[model samples]
Target chain A: MSFFGPGHGACPGCGLTIATRNVLEALEGKCFVSNSTGCLEIVSSQYERSAWGVPYIHSLFENAAAVAAGIELALKALKRTDEGKVVVFAGDGATADIGIGPLSGMLDRNHDVIYICLDNEAYQNTGNQQSGLTPTGSNTTTMPAGELMPGKTGRKKDMISIAVGHGIPYVATATVAFYADLRRKVKKAAEIEGAKYIQIHTPCVTGWGIDGKQTLESARLAFETALYPIIEYENGELTKVRKIKDRKPVEEYLRIQRRFRHLFKHPKGQEIIRILQKIADDNAAKFNLDV
Target chain B: MKKVVRGFYSIAHSVKLCKPNVIAAYPITPQTEIVENLAKMYSNGELGDCEYVTAESEFGAASILVGASAAGARTFTATCSQGLVLMSEVLLNAAGMRLPIVIVNTNRALSAPLSIWNDHQDSMLLRDGGLIQIHVETNQEAHDMVPLAFKVAENPRVMLPFMVNMDGFKLTHAYEPVDLLDQEIVDSFLPPYEPPVYMTTKNPLTFGSYAPPHCYAEFRVTLQNAMMRALDEIEKAYKDWAEITGRYWGGHAVGEYTDDAELVVVSMGSLTGMVRDVVNEMRREGKKVGLLKLRTFRPFPVKEVRNALKNANKILVFERAVSFGYEGPVGIEVKSAIFGFTPEFYSFAVGLGGRDVPREEIVKIIGDVYEGKVEQGFHFGTIKEFEEVVV
Candidate 1:
């Protein structure tokens, strides 16, 4: 049985929706889900209509992990831990920025739950606002590239490392393009007993100003360019990596998305391009993502 | 048996007797002792089969309790001041989802100068959060109200959250002789929570979902109806507890001694204890004055308020919080309740931020009202030096 159904409020070619579908499909419909306030919550469960067939709760914007932890503890209190899986869904803004403290607390407490963050790099639901996960040299509503300042100043927050630092049993990164890998990671997290975190690189067509059909292509290029590396860690130990062979240059990924189009315009644009390439190079070196 | 204990221990002892399945809390000043005592009990095996969660923040604690309560477990939490403010969002979510969670809000002031002192502003901010707000007078009532709050909130007719407001530091730190009921009696009085519906895998259902305007208004109306129904449930719970323990106050919603009195002073929470003493002194000296204590603030008890104050020749409202530029929080509601009545109304903003309003100070304010020296609207008795300030 499918947990998440089709035909809801999700936008066309929404990468987060694709990743959510793949994750829930891997669960085989035996789970209780909690969602933080974001696009996924707004789109999936609007008024009388619900896209989720499984038991679900949508709480505030930054408390999904805590909510899921309570559910897990409640199930344990009722002696029904084996009956279902407890999972939490949140966006990058909720996970990396506003919700990081509670998310860290849940991991510190070692609750039996899975926290999946659909990282679209920026806040796409509230009209593409800037978030902590917004990458450098990308335009968001709050951090627009103008004559005065560049797109975003800093690199995206490294949430995988934060999860690993909590000494959780499992932490992984995946992209929507790698459906098999995403499914495998979700299933693996569900099987674990302690806190598990999986961050999925979800490409947003509207936020990035790309064609709806180009969502998958952009996700693939993200992986190839080492901008969104697929890495897995088990109990603070790096266990798996998706190495890139014939690694594509960061230019290929940047050219298609208009969020980064301004990086090719002004005299300062070339320098901003170099900064973006350095981020990719650093990730490639750190995760050994290049062949 | 009656024992002299800090007000915080009374709350902890009452919670122990209530036997909640889960308690998730973060410590804030004036509210920390209650959670600390519970944590000690959980560690010492005195609190049985309860999951005591020490959350990262007040927001996280409130969220945890909401989830636990929605999952069909009896849940509790305690917080004050900024902690309560931080949990404000989760409070609305819990109430909207109809989770019968019980919380003790040690009332404290919001900060610009950053003081962890007593005031009603914290709980006043949550007046419309759809939870039952009960203000307590004595430490015994603070103890007694815990089980009562749980019973009323978890009742099938209500099924809404409840908040018990006790003045921060003033009552929370005071030592008093509280006659806590026997464990057996408390157990029989407040039964285990059995929610009609919950979040579970067996019977899958969505909670806290997005509601369109059509569906949203109905939920709000339903919640309001539940609040109204809670008045009866609260009385029933109190009556049932009184029948077993022989400790009945006038009513669960309000208590008044306005009969045969010309002037009535209205107030709530621990501050009422001081007001009651002052009124008693004034009565023994042959003054025609009485006291009206508001026990319930959310369901408002508007009818009781109007009925209690209707016969008085003059009415005065003493409260610990202000509505910024307007009257005191409770004062405005009291005025609305008695709109058609013809008592010369006066409101005094007093005892804010844990400022001790001694019996002499209360007597002076009453004395001013008696001599017709006070104006028709609001007055600040203690802060007269800065009465010219906007608030």
Candidate 2:
């Protein structure tokens, strides 16, 4: 009983496609979804055709959380709370950049909503622009690897910690590579009574210049290298972490993607690679990701 | 039923009587009292089954209303000036989606060298944003326009967003005698909002879909047709409310006083009150002067405006907002409405940025226009002499 139907216009091996399907399937049609302006919304809900089998709305780029909050309050006000949960799907740019203010307001209001940030790391829909979630040493159209500069010069914003700082009832991180784990988080978020936020590491094949079939492989490498931690929090307390049995090096994750291919050729490439490794090391230490 | 109250309190009471399901608004000066009063009502349990949300920004407030309205709830919010500008994107989206939401805009000047005072520049900036815009003259009219706005907006034939514009500090802060509508009468006038289609799990629906170039213009045409249809809905709402309360603000759109008058003053918002007084005083002196209060700004009331001013020899179109390089917005629309009817039309930008439109100023502008002392084009009504500044 999946709500996200097929025949949509997502690119081949689109990670958002897999994450959207997994989240909707976990909800089992007992949710109303609002989408921000992004690849998922444009592809799934073009006029005269919609891929959503559940009630859906796409208002604007930055107001999905606020809109979902309105939906939650409306259902409560209309005495239709038993109908379904209210969920929002926004891209990383929508979540961390243009939409952060409204998202924080929604969480601050503690509306009964599940906000899912489809973190493809960059604005993949708009041809791979640099987003707040774009990691360091990643090449994007806006932040290209020129002679003087390496790749992106900043680290990915720690959005999970920001969500936790809002003191919501539930906050978690998942990856599209791990469908079962992502589904479990969705179900748990649905069961929570207050605001819930989940940031999914949905790797972008086009943006990362990876092969179409390597979307899931890239997602797996992201988590396995400890660069994208899979962790959960309940009531602002860390409750779960996906520990790695044999943690891979960050070089293995960076080498396959063309976004980081420039890092190996540039004179200052090794230093940036070392910086990326230290980020992964910090995440592993912070989340206790070792078996 | 008559009580003296601030304009914001009157608007708040009117909205409460209409029984909105969701009220999400952020506080802005002059517009803050309306939501604050509503919040107080909600806290006091006067607003039954209503969800009151204090949004972080006007964008959030307008977006919440859009979501609630899409979910089949009667929703509302209020904003002005910069706040209205912030909510511009979501407001257009709501109109495109044909969501029947009512917004009360306490008109204020736009910023740079910021002024929170009364002006129509805010609402005028969104003149073509696909929302039904109606201006009010006094606090009493502002109170009456809320339920009427909701009725017209929720009319299945209309199903468009409505914006009721009232001057910021002029009407919002001023106390006036208002005859509040009884809840029973309001409930009978505006039935429960039953949208044709809405977001529900039992029956899924998609809203705000992406339109290709092949069909985008058609959707916009549909919205334009909805605005055109709103004219009739506004008339019907006005008729029904007048039937219940016996208070008619105007006929269709323009409230006219052109009884065989040659010079007719055309204006909207609270400035109309001062113009009305000036016209009455001039009429007592046997001068051929009259006033046309523009109630509905959007859907321009073209037919009514042309009909009302066709007999006049001189038409003075006064407005509080300018269109920058062009003339006053209302003045441009008026000239366009009666293009062929050459009646020596004069455009005047007056009372801008909270400057007071005194009765003397109104009389002086009319006198200047009638005497042919001012040009036929746009003219600033009152400009103070410049003072030396030691910058």
Candidate 3:
């Protein structure tokens, strides 16, 4: 039985909705989900079916982390601390912008909970607003690129690095692209005694301006190109790199989406591609993926 | 016995007496001194058996309090200006989830113009944020409001956040002699928090829900009903405080200063002291003027304001902050408090951003309202007749 529930209302190719179902399925109803206000919140929690068979709480866009901390405490107060898991789920916008305070606080306090940031890379709920997670050379509604240059200027925040920086018990990177790995990591987090962090590479098809069927394809391409490398830390030490396959050139990942079309628009097109290549190379070295 | 302390320290002194189990806070201007002092006390062993959270931001501070309180700890937090805005999200979570978190905000104007001093804008903005709002007139009231805030907030019927505001600079920086309550008495009177359900993994539960529309609408109604029922809780809290301190917070929303007279000047915050003196001076000169100092801003004590104000023919509302497009915020709220009874009021916005409002100006405002010269309203210390804009 699906622990998150039946008839999930996620859009046809919504990676997050699928990822959430996978998460709950892995936890097997021994979890309390704290969701932040975002696209996932509206779709799954709107009118009728909750889509969540397990208990869930939705706090403000900025406070899901804090509420999750409260849930962990609730379990302790109830004297069932060992029997269940506490989970905080949010979009990139909430995790990076509004919910950062509580998230950081949770990590600092080393509260026993798994904070899963579903990085679809843009503020998909507010009409594709550019968020802190938006990769460079991508067109968000806020940072729409045209003939002159590529899209978003900055690179995606190294959230896994940031999480590790907080010295939490576990910090890992996984994706809906790798369901088995995702479930394994989630279960491991639930078993840990303190704060755990996971960055799930869930792509927003509509926001990314890609065909719905390309959801998983793009997710796989992302990891293959080193654009989304999967790494893990234990006891605050960088320990593992999930060596799955060889690297694909970064341009192959960018070519599929119109949002990244600006990167190939002009004389500076090759320059943008070069920058993207450098990003992938950088991730490869930092995460020690080449070994 | 008298002890001199800054408004912030005075608040801290009382908080120490209350003996909170958790002091969760991050620093922000004006109000930071309170939390900083508490942290010092917690570390130096001046306070015992407490967890002092050195948090990341105001939001985190509020959240830490929630977590600590859920773990059956008495908690508190202090913030101001943008910190208040940042805590906006946590504030609602604290109230809606029925967490009795005590929040102290030093009144500071919100950003755009970026003045970091006295203004009611920050506290006024959260007037409808499902928290009990108490504005203080002096260090004594600021010191007193905390215990009452805790009692009112902890009453299960009103398990929401409560803001005890002490105006920045005017109160936060000003030093005054305050008679602190004894710790033994406080411990005996204000019992420690023991929640019915604490946050634990042992027996898990969720707060806040991914509520569908059917459930969402009902929750809002429940919040409304709960807030309405808090009036009784506030009274009971007051009664409890009175039994201990012998202070009468029984005036409902509006505190009186010769309120039986024909002319009443309505005001809030520390400005009440100036208005009180002006009204009494006006009364001595055979002028039928009085003052209504509002201590409670939220749940707007509608009944006492109307009953006490019914005898007045002319009412003058003095607000320390503007509402941008509308009339003075306090003036608008005051008129709404006595709406149907129809007390003719001249609303004024004055002394925003720490600009002083002298007693003479208050007397002039009272005279203007009495003589019906304030056609729209008045703005203290302006080039021309700065009346409250009626939109």
- DockQ leader: 2
Can you write out model 2's per-residue Cα lDDT over B162-221, one digit (the tens) per residue?
999999989899999998889998888889899989999999999889999998999999
Q: Please, what is the whole-model Cα lDDT of each candidate in the order they appear?
A: 0.88, 0.91, 0.79
* Candidate 1 per-residue C-alpha lDDT over A1-291 given as tens digits, one digit per residue, 9 for 90 to 100: 457866477878999889988888898778889898988898888867888888899988899999998998788777777768889999999999999988998999999999999999898889789998998888889989899767988888889889999999999999999999899999989888899999999988889999989999999999999988899999999999999999888999999999999888855778888887898998899988888
DockQ order of candidates, best first?
2, 1, 3
Q: For this target, which candidate reaches the highest lDDT against the unseen true structure?
A: 2
Candidate 2 lDDT by residue in tens digits, A1-291:
448867689889999989999998898889999999998998899998799999999999999999999999899999999999999999999999999999999999999999999999999899999999999989999999999889798889989989999999999999998999999999999998999999999988889999999999999999999999999999999999999989999999999999999999898899999999999999899989999
lDDT of 2 at B23: 97
Pairs that clash in candidate 2: none
TM-score of each: 0.97, 0.98, 0.84
How many steric overlaps does candidate 2 have?
Answer: 0
Task: Decide which is better by TM-score, 1 or 3.
Answer: 1
Error of 2 at B178 (Å): 0.8
Question: Which prediction has more favorable lDDT, 1 or 2?
Answer: 2
Q: In terms of docking quality, how is candidate 1 classified?
A: medium
lDDT of 1 by residue, B1-391 (tens): 9999999999999999998888997989999999999999999999787889999999999999878887888999999889989999999889998999899999998998787999898999998899899988889988888988898999989998899999888889999999977789888888888889988778778888899877889999999999999888788887887898887865644544688778899988887878888888888888888889988999888888888888888989997888997879888998899998988989888878877788888989997887788888888768655446675
In angstroms, give how far residue B41 of model 3 lies from its true place: 2.5
Please name the candidate that would achieve the greatest TM-score relative to the true structure.
2
